[model samples]
Target: MIMRRPAVAGQFYPGNENDLRELIKKLAPEHTPSKIPALGVVAPHAGYIYSGRVAAEVYASIEEAPTFVILGPNHYMYGSAVALSTQEWMTPLGNVQVDEDFIDCLPIGIIDKDELAHRSEHSIEVQIPFLQYFFKDFKIVPIALGLQDYDTIKELAGELVKAIEKYDERVVIIASSDFTHYEDVDVAHRKDRALIKTIEQLDVPAFYDELYRINASTCGYGPIGAMMMACRERGAKYGKLLRYATSGDVTGDRQVVGYAGIAVY
Candidate 1:
């Protein structure tokens, strides 16, 4: 079987298993997680020190699931519009089994096996340690999408719903995205709020419209939009913002990247 090792291990997170486990323990919140399970969640994909706390907070709120469908943006744009991986993802913590069953069932237009697209993408990889920290036994379906129009995302969502039904009923959808990249801290906040509002309201179409019209500088808007549709189709009524922050909060930088953890229930 092909093993997909970490591409950003030493850079974005610890490359050693012991160190990774310890860092996650340190960053985790100290409150009991809610019993309410979420259908989907949106988490940031920055380095651990910058966005780990927010990601951990949102993760702490989720209930158990058999599988996780992680959707992320293709920052490098090396593969197909929607790329899937057949290999297992190797993190410092351990190897995460990819839900090959689900990937095989996905329509070709929705997702195709493309290891190159996932090889160097940090967006989806950053969230795996959190999964390792939170659950003992669960598989993942990692999808990387390029800049696709809303119509494309809508079609992908329908395929995703069918894939989920064919794969696992107990699943949690996660979209890895960093909002408002490399803007003034104030400007980043302003732009990210627009995206967050749509996420909290669980407005899929409005999210696409705002991302285009307002030019909300989010890198993974497509992933978020796809998750919104998946959540809606799964019968989620509302979404809530668990936490929000920017890189400026960790580093004293004028130009910052906005980060947030949103829960869709």
Candidate 2:
């Protein structure tokens, strides 16, 4: 059995299991909000210190699902344009199984089941601990995208919907992403908010247009677009931004990466 080990445990999050749990508990908001059966969500993938609270808010707001399809950018530009990993992912929390059946249901050739792409990618890896925290029994389908063109993302979303329909299982798609990168705190918020407004409308094209217009350095545009497309195809009407912050908020750094937690239902 192939095991995908944690690549950024000590760096992006705590290496110790107990510490990871404790940190998540602390990052999670004290007031509980009734969870929504969201179709999809957009969560950030920066170091937990920078974006953990944003991610926690997104996960905490969503209703638990039997399977979660996580789409994240292939930041290293490795492997196939659209790559999927079938290996069980390991975290400090435990091993989380991949939903192989769901992958099999997807139309062939569109996504390469390439483990190389996910071997060291941190975007998808960081979200698992949060899942392990909230749900007792759940599986994940992790897709790393090296390509984010409009046609490609739309096609990918179509196949995703097809797989969901065939499997008939409760599932949610999580697009792991961080917004503006390495910009002044004010600049990051300005650009990210403009791009986010398009996302709130569920207008994928507008999101892309605004992204290119501002030359926003969002690392997961493809993943975010894919999620919006798939969720809309599933009859999701609107998206809500549960939280928005930046690394600057945590460190008071002049340059920061924007993070947002949004839910679609």
Candidate 3:
């Protein structure tokens, strides 16, 4: 099996195993994850120092599961709206096995096995280590979404629901995304709050509507929208915001990328 090694390791997070472990622990510092069932979660995908704490908060709230369906934006990839990979992903912590079997089970017919689409992408890659930190031996099905069209996301959500029923597996869905990018801190908060409000209500239509209404720049919104639909299908009533921050918090810059951690159960 081809190994999907880290492409942004040294730049986005620690390159060494010990250092990576220390950083994760330092960010979490005795954080205890919830045992309650989780249908889906949303976490940021920037560098660890800027977004790790918030990501950890959402991860901490999710109950342990054998498999995770991780959806992330295709920031650099092209050609396919949905790119699915069936390879082991390597991170500083260790190798996270891809759920190849589950990947084959998805009912969506538009997806393609496009490893090249994931080669230079950091969004999904950034979430692997956090999953490794939380669970000892869990597989992940990583999909990079390049489009945020409404009908596409809605159809993908329905397919996911059918796939879950066909497989009869208890899985957790995760969306790796930043709230808003390169906006003034005040404007970023306003845009992100509007987006988060829709998220909390689990209103897929409102979620998609407000995204364009406010001109929000969430890179992985397609995945977030799909996960929200899956959450609602699985009986998730609401989403709780765990944490929200921005690059400005770390760099002291006026222009920042908004980040948030939300859990749906």
Highest-scoring model, lDDT: 2
lDDT of 1 by residue, 1-265 (tens): 6788899998999999999889989888898555458989999999999999999888877887878999999999998878887789999988999876766777766567788899899999999999999889989998899766788778888988887777645888898998998989988888888878988888888888888886778888888888999889989888888889999998999989899899999
Q: Model 2 over residues 1-265: C-alpha lDDT tens digits? A: 6799999999999999999999999999888689988999999999999999999999888899999999999999889899999999999999999998887899875889899999889999999999999889999999999999899999999999999999978989999999999999889989999988988889999999998899999999999999999999999998999999999888988899999999998
Flag the better candidate by TM-score, 2 or 3. Answer: 2
lDDT of 3 at 28: 76
Regions of model 2 farther than 4 Å from truth: none
Question: For residues 1-265, could you state the per-residue lDDT of candidate 3 as single tens digits?
Answer: 6888899999999999999988988887365644558789999999999999898777777788878988898887664788888888998888888876677678747677788878899999998888888778789988888876888778777877777777656788998899899999999999999999999999989988898899888888999999999889988999988889999999999999999999888
Q: Clash number for model 3?
A: 0
Task: Flag regions of model 1 displaced more than 4 Å.
Answer: none
Please give the distance, in angstroms, between residue 100's alpha carbon in candidate 2 and its true position after superposition: 1.6
TM-score of 3: 0.96
C-alpha lDDT of all candidate models, in order: 0.87, 0.93, 0.86
Tell me each candidate's RMSD, in Å, in order: 1.4, 0.8, 1.4
lDDT ranking, high to low? 2, 1, 3
TM-score (C-alpha) between model 2 and the true structure = 0.98
